[model samples]
Target: MSQFVIIGGGVIGLMTTLQLADAGHEVTVVERGECGRESSWAGGGIVSPLYPWRYSTPVSRLASWSEGAYPELAFRLLEETGIDPEYRQKGLLYLRVDDEARALEWARAVGKPLSRVGPEEIYSREPQACPGVEEALWMPTLGSIRNPRLMQALRARLEAMPSVSIVEHCEVKGLVGDRQRVSSVETSRGNLAADQVVICGGAWSARLLELAGLQLPVRPVKGQMLLFKARPGLVNRVVLMDGRYVIPRADGRVLAGSTLEEAGFDKQTDDQARESLKASACAIIPALADYEIEHHWAGLRPGSPDGVPFIGRAPGWDNLFVNAGHYRNGLVLAPASTHLLVDLLLERSPIIDPEPYALEGRVGHTA
Candidate 1:
């Protein structure tokens, strides 16, 4: 069996480690901080892209495949770890869509559940929906998993696996070896020799790649969100409008977010973000104005230019692979992306085409 070291312990790294270990490869996950305490935990957990038609075909393919795979994974995780990921198909509703024809066509192409609905239909479903909307798009298959709980379930399940080991607060400083392969990892704790290395670092992936003489553009995009401790039934499902969304969890707490700011790595939550999100939430569902803001936080999502992650062997490095730059859809894209990464790493046929995410010609050079 080969020894694999996956850098970054967020949802992506943890999921990748799980798959590699399942294949009987001893895998170690190294994280700069606590696992799952980054973008994976901070996101709204929407299983589909906000605007499906806007993303490229590669992103759509990965997301479409992962959308169908989450339910069974959530169920199995709960049964084994006793931690509920809270996977629910409460559906997603959009107050206004700019390109109805394109969205409908794209929905048909990808086989995702979507339909055009009238204002009355929206009100009948979500009584607290925003007014003055003529029509809306209802996506019955799209839903959310409580990502923090999902993280708990994954970490718990991986902990029990003898082939899997997670290293927290262990910073991976650089990659050590020739261009043909990464023979070891230089970390804060010390050096780890590995037969293979996969860099799953999120926003900091560019920095890590720089150590390998690559210039991939994986910048950090900050998103701020606010939580309202309202009743569970206040909003029936997820609401989307103007690139902002409000998610209602199974518990009494509701999540309204977020702001897409190009703020480097500073994840500081400001008053401006809180007010902006609160205003949007209240505008969408006026009942939210009655509740106090319970939590305000921010996370740096790995912003990619085309919303597609690089998931293939690093150019000029035979045993080095990358699966980062997933932008806003990492939670939904992790399962399929991890599968593709392991597939290429094992010299097996990939689940999806790997041409778009290749590093030499367009992937890393673009960044």
Candidate 2:
């Protein structure tokens, strides 16, 4: 079995580690901070892309596969680790308050069964919504998961693996080897050897690759999100209004998000972004106007020129692989990404083509 050293301990890294360990490979996760505290913890936990069908076919296929894998994974993790990821199937209710033509076309393109719900039906489904809302597109298969809990459960599962080791507060500085192959990683802790090194550092992917004398064209897109104290049943399902979304959890807390800013690695919460999200949330469900805002934070999504993530091996390097640039869909695509990467590493046929997710395409592809 090949010994694999994975950089970053976010959802992608942890999930990949789990899959590798399950395949009986020796794995070690080197994390800069506590596991899963980065973008994985800060994501909205939406199980699909903002618009699944509008994305590339490869992206849609991977997302769909990951969504299907989530239920079984959640159940197994809950049973083994005694922690629930709160995987809910409440479905997504997308309101087309402005763009009816585009919404209908997108719905049709996705091939998912969608029904146009009038204001009365929408109100009946979610009474807390504001008046003057025209119609909504209901996609019943879409849902969300609690990110923090999922990360916690993944950490517990990884800890239980006899062949997996986690070294926290271990920031990777650079790679140690020639241009053709990487033999070890230079971390703040020390030099650690590995048969192969997979970089899953999320927003920091490009910089990490630069240390190995390769430039990955990944940018950090900043997103600010907020949480509100909501009553159970206040919002029965996830609501998408224009570009904003309000997600209700099993607990009484509602997630009001988010603003996508082209800020490079700036994770500070801005007051303007927070207020704008609040305004957008209140516009969708006016009852939220009175709800107390619980928390406000920001995260950096590793965005590529195109929406597709950069997976597979970096060009010119045989042993160095990359799995970053997931951007906003990292949580939804985690399972399929891990499955595909493991298959590639073991020389097995992947469920989908790995060409679209290749890292070399990042520099040339424009979206």
Candidate 3:
């Protein structure tokens, strides 16, 4: 079996390690912080992009594939670990304020099931819905999973695999590679040899590649979120607008988020951002104005110029690969991203076309 070392312990790294270890490979994941507590834990947990049409083809394909795979994965995780990720098909509702025609066209082109709901119908479905919402585009098949629970389940499952070992609180310094392949990874602890190395470092991916004198064209986009305690079913579905969203969890906690600031790795939550999100949440569901604020936090999402994650081999090194720069959709795209990159590593037929995600012509240059 191949010995693999993955950098970064967010959802991408953990999920990829789970899959790799399940396939009989010896896998080790190194994380600077606790596993699954970065962007993966900080996200709203929607299984699809907030506005699917606004993204690139690579982003859409990976998202679509991962969306399709979530059900079975969630079921398996629940059965194996007894920690339900709370995967629910609660659907997504786009509160329309212009961009309707573009959204309709995108739905048609992508063949996603979408239906227009009037304001009255929307209110009837969700009495807490905000006013001035003329209409909404409903994608009933879209859903969400409790991301922290999902992370818990994944990490638990990975821990159960003897082939998989996680090294946390250990930062990866750099990669030691020759001209053709990466030989080892230099970490805060020590150097570890690997048959292959996958950089699932999320926003920190670019810095990791700098050790090899390469850049991955990925940056950290900080997002602040607010959690509210409300009655269960406060918002019946994921309500999205203007790059912000309201996500209701299985519990009574309603999540209102987020601000996409290009704030490099600063994950400190701002009071101004919290107030802005509260305003948006209240505007969406007026009753939310009365709910108690539960928590506020921020995470640094991996942002790329094209919104497409770098998910293939590194430019020069034959044994090094990347699966980062997912930005806001890391949770939505983790399944397919891990699948495609692992398929490439295993020399198996990929489930999705890998061209758009290839690294050869994209961001990274030969080192």
- For each candidate in turn, the TM-score is 0.97, 0.95, 0.97
Model 3 agreement with the true structure over 110-190: per-residue lDDT tens digits = 899988998787877777887777778888899899999999999999988899889999988878878678889999999
Off by over 4 Å in 1: 363-367
Query: For residues 1-367, could you state the per-residue lDDT of candidate 1 as single tens digits?
Result: 9999999988889999988888999998999999999999999998888888889989988998898899988999999999999998989998778888999998888677789999889988889887778899999878789999999999999999998888999988878887687889999999998999988889999888888888888899999999999997998789998888999888868899989999899999999889999999998899999998899999999998888898887888878889999999999899999988888888889998888877767554323
Q: lDDT per model, in order?
A: 0.89, 0.86, 0.88
Q: Per-residue lDDT for 227-301 in model 2, tens only?
A: 999888888788888778998889868898888899787899978988899999998888898889989999888
Q: Over all chains combined, what TM-score does candidate 1 have? A: 0.97
Better of 1 and 2 by TM-score: 1
* Candidate 3 segments whose C-alpha is farther than 4 A from its true place: 364-367
What's model 1's overall lDDT? 0.89
